[model samples]
Target: MFTKEKEFFSILFEAVSEGVIVVNTQQNIVATNQSAENMFGYNKKELETAPLIQLIPKNYHHNHHTYVNGFMKKNESRQMGVGRDLFGIKKNGDIFPVEVGLNPFTVRGETFVMALVVDITLRKQHQDQIQELNAKLEQKVIERTKELSEAVNKLKEVNAELDDENKKRLKAENKAKEALKKEKELNELKTKFLSLVSHEFKTPLSGILTSAMLLSKYKLEEQQQRRDKHIKTITDKVHYLNNILNDFLSIEKLERGKIQYNPSQFKISKVVNEVIYNANMMLKDGQIINYPENIDNYSIYQDEKIVELALSNLVYNAIKYSSENTVIDIKIKQNLDSTTFIVEDNGIGIPEKDQKNIFKRYYRAENALLTQGTGIGLNIVKSHLENLKGNIYFNSKENQGTTFWFSLPNKYQTKL
Candidate 1:
């Protein structure tokens, strides 16, 4: 029965997870379990004489001694895992996290301290791993912030470049506009110079031509052919000079708003015939003039002189711009309350982009630059037609042909 009781108590002490040790007030270990021997790296026989301070790290030995002395003086119990971090030194001199509990007891007038110690190394390792991960996460966040800052800076640089490009574009556009305005002023000056020269020369030129014609009547028979040739030269020169003078004078009057319109009744057929006859004089040898047969004998109320000038300008332009031996078509028709005049030509047509400004003063189609023109012909025609409450329009295809149309009121038309 005694062996059974001793075996039961030994089994109970050895089975405890905590290492247990009992020490006297002198700090020498009096009793210990198998767990305590294994925890402190001491055999049961060695533990009998071992000092309790042997289980403490060298750095913590003095403090532990002081605490134990104080606890013994107060005769109180102490708990572990509350006041400070506690660690123990193993036989291998390796330090490990631990929790220590102390209980003081008196039996038979002998004082002893019961100590319970647990290994906490696994918990401490877990805490350390979490701390390490948190530090790594914080570092990653800092790197990401740096990347974002760099991206924002690059975006700012791009925006700056765009702003600079916009400024340059605007400057280039302004410079181009200024250049266009200066070119327009220069063209106006050239037109004025041509007008002045033509005006000063036309009167003398006409007088010379007339005198030459009169001289033709009384000529030596031997020199008669020479006289005829000279007369023809003078007439041609006068005719060319008259055309130049007329273009200039028309532009000047239109600019000064001095064109007078006298609307009157005129035979449409007679006017059409006269214009056709004049146009034929300038046609190439094989070029044909097609006129509508039997145009309506409608008496149109409009400025006869202005209408005739406008028609002549259109026919002359058609002949000037077309290839040699090409056909020019003229048609006149009477509508219910209006008269229509159409001039069609197979020529180098105005470009689509330039057609809008074709009627503007001083504006010429790019294709018409080689032709001798002041660019004021269509502008004058538009003004004269407006005064008579008429409308004029044109259709053209580049490299194909052009067709121009004008509609005048058959009678006196009101404000359009």
Candidate 2:
């Protein structure tokens, strides 16, 4: 019956897929299944009585004795090396990874250790392959990242270079535009200056020459009245020429920054009466200039001469442009902060297209070509008034009338 039970167990152990290795307390292999033999590269029934160390690597023989003695002393059954990997040796001196479960039992009053061994060579090889592939993949990713970083750096450098170039190009363009504008302004000044000198001098010189020639014919003492008329005409022409020269001189001083401005407190009505008295000298037949009644007592603190020049220019324009029997109205309005001077005339009004350019240097309205003017009065007045912190604007309708309004800040400082 004992033999029958042993045969039954051997058959049962042989059917297991894992190798069943049985060892005595002395660590000698007492029994091994066919699976154990096959796992260690052994033939059938060839592993009996072999020292268990023979199946371990030569380097692991001393450790195996300690492990077996510890296991026997502990008298507990468990897996070998629970938290670590295990290694195994084959009959042909080959080493491979393994997993081991140990069982201890007393069979017929003898102690024995049963080791359940699984040859995990293929699993270890697959793990090694996976680790190698992962290492290669990691290296590739690092290289690719480096290349992308380099590319991004290069793109940034290129963009920086492009921005610098764009800024330089914009600066060059702005410089060119400024240069062109200055050159155009210079050319315009030259052309208009020549035109003004030619027109102004030619008319006055012709008048003086004509009057002198007529006065030469009236040399007899009885022609005194006729000679006096010619003398008066000559005097007026000389005065007109002198006024033109003064306008040119003012422009030169303005350009050279040499004009001196003096600010003082002056009564508005005083300035008004003075300007109206002078403007009355140039009034035509049946024409009259009417100022508002009871002018305000506001005392403006500003360059009184500039205000006079501006007002004189406006009233002079009104008297020169209007027809006979037309009434020119001078209106004055004062706010708390500013003073307004309005000169309204029923005259040959400015053309719509000509009004915008009326204040430009040497600009004359086409309708006023026959009139006696050098076209410098309004521009000079405008510049002087601006220096005094004032502004001028006008309203006009063709063949109807013209109204010019200029404003002055009640409080201002002289700009030297």
Alpha-carbon lDDT of model 1 = 0.80
Residue ranges of candidate 2 with Cα displaced over 4 Å: 1-150, 219-224, 414-416
Q: Which candidate's TM-score is highest?
A: 2
- Residue 309 Cα positional deviation in candidate 1, in Å, after optimal superposition: 1.3
Q: Residues 1-416, candidate 1: write the lDDT tens digits.
A: 12444576467668887898888898988777888788878788887768988888889876777888888888777885487898888888988888888889886687888888888888889989988999998998898988999999999999999999999999999999999988998788678567645654655576676768767675778877777767766776677677766776877886687776677888887787788898888887677878766775677887788778778788878888888988989888887899888889998999999999999766779988756566767987887787678889999998788999888888865343
Model 1 scores a TM of 0.48
Error of 1 at 58 (Å): 99
Cα lDDT of model 2 by residue, 1-416, tens digit: 12656787688789899999989998988788888998999864577788888788877777788889999988789999889788888888889889999999887888898999999899989999999999999998999999999999999999999999999999999999999998998899789779778887998899999999999899789999999999999998998888888888998887788889878899888888899998887899999999866577777888888888888888988999999999999888888899899999999999999999999888899999888787888988888878777889999998999999999888985464
Q: Lowest lDDT 10-mer window, candidate 1? A: 1-10
Error of 2 at 383 (Å): 2.6
Candidate 1 residues lying further than 4 Å off, grouped into runs, are 1-230, 413-416
Which candidate leads the pack in lDDT? 2
lDDT of 2: 0.87
Residue pairs clashing in model 1 are none
